[model samples]
Structures are given as structure tokens and as C-alpha cells.
Target: HRFGITFHRNKRSKAAINTELETIPGIGEKTVIELLRHFRSVSKVKKASETALSEVIGPAKAKIIIKHYQQTTNEN
Candidate 1:
């Protein structure tokens, strides 16, 4: 199957999950590892505060992550 983007945590394929996160600006493989280590899951990451995320991924990337989620939130 072709690679696809998905926000749903139920996706069993790691490629799908990684592809989705990689779409977020500034989130590459290293950051993805950091995020997963810090938050364990996407839901946890989505609910994390900027300050908490900044501590994990630095404030700049934290802002990007927060903004990305916020924009996705507003769009829904």
C-alpha cells in the first residue's frame, strides 16, 4: 500500500505514524524519537503544554509542534 498520513493512534504501521509526524514542520526522525520518549503517544504529545514540550524538544520546535496541533485543532 502507498504511504499515507494518519493522526489516529490506532494505526499499527510505524511508517504511517512516522509519516504523519514527519509532516509537522521541524519534526524529523530525531525529534520524533525525542517526542515519543517524552510523551509516549500522540495524544500525550498533543495535550502537552509549550513549556513542557520546550523542555523536551526546545522552545522553537515546541512552538512549531504546538502551532501545528493548534492549527489542526482549529481546522476540525
Candidate 2:
């Protein structure tokens, strides 16, 4: 029973991990779409340098946006 509970929790955690970019602090569905259009994948976004991200996301939001994704990826 305890093992089953832990497995369920782990599955939920993994799902949450996969959606971190979709849930980024200032990013909404539209922005996520735009990001996908520009980068093709969350992995591409994550792999971008701050300067590259700024080019796509803009300077005002780039630092916060990149930092949010970086922190989430680092945490996981």
C-alpha cells in the first residue's frame, strides 16, 4: 500500500516536472505558443543562453523568464 502511494506521488511529480515551462511565472498559453514557434521545444528554450532568450522573449522579461525555467530545471 505504501509503495503504491509513493508510486502515484512520483508519477504526479514527473507530470509536474514536464509542465514547468508551461507554468512559468509570467508565461501564459499564448506566450508558450510563441515560444514554441520560435524554439520548437522546451529543451531548446532551456538550452538557450540568456542573450538568445532575450532575443526571442525580449529584455524586459528575458531574465525573469530564463531564471524561472533555469531554477525549475535545476530543482528537478
Candidate whose TM-score is highest = 1
* TM-scores, all models, native as reference: 0.73, 0.61
Cα lDDT of model 1 by residue, 4-61, tens digit: 4443333545534554567897788779878887788878988999999999989999
RMSD of each: 8.2, 9.4
Residue-level lDDT tens digits of model 2 in 22-51: 766777666666666798888887887889
Estimate every model's Cα lDDT from 0 to 1.
0.81, 0.74
Candidate 1 Cα errors over 4 Å, as ranges: 1-19
